[model samples]
Target: GAGVSQSPSNKVTEKGKDVELRCDPISGHTALYWYRQRLGQGLEFLIYFQGNSAPDKSGLPSDRFSAERTGESVSTLTIQRTQQEDSAVYLCASSRDSYTGELFFGEGSRLTVL
Candidate 1:
């Protein structure tokens, strides 16, 4: 029963570059979600996928961001043309249901745009 996990824990990059963050969710969980938390702000839902159902990408910030999930297991978030405003902690969570409070979050992938 592995929990959600993320890579690099921290990332520092220059503006206008591209970055890809990875996430590994718990096994047997059909619901996965991606969220972003900027400084002094709340978590913003980016994308969510449940089983073979249609994936929800409504919360993505701009055309520069995208995500994908495979077999309800792993997910990756990509940011193209990174801006300073994109600097924040990209968090991944998964639960049995989106409305459930049992969602678990990884340590988060922290990105710094300079």
Candidate 2:
């Protein structure tokens, strides 16, 4: 996928387990973001990375969740000690540096904790 690519489209993990979700954005995109959506709920921003600037992680739900982006290319979202409440669709998006550009989103990785 030239737009955005995510691996392990669906995941089921035991409670207290850890999971990693990966994202590859379009080449040259300078902005990347991670969002979560629970069933029947709107997307909630988790983190944002733009260029060399420090990432904005204030939207993360807890300390157990974190994301890393390498040079605006690929990003990995890690969730530690997963719980049922952490189940959701994790969406990745990327866009050009311009503020007016539209974000290209991945199909999302669905996580289910049991």
Best by lDDT: 2
Q: Write the per-residue lDDT of candidate 2 for residues 1-114, one digit (tens) a residue.
A: 677999889999999999999999989989888999999999999988896354579999999998888776889999999999999999998888649579999999999999
TM-score list, all predictions:
0.91, 0.94
Give the distance in Å from residue 38's predicted Cα in candidate 2 to where it truly belongs. Answer: 0.5
- The CA lDDT of each predicted structure is 0.87, 0.90
Model 1 residue pairs with clashes: none
Candidate 1 per-residue lDDT, tens place, 1-114, comes to: 478999879999999999999988888788888899998799998988886354667899899998877777778899999999999999998897766669988989999999
The ten-residue window of minimal lDDT in model 1 covers: 49-58
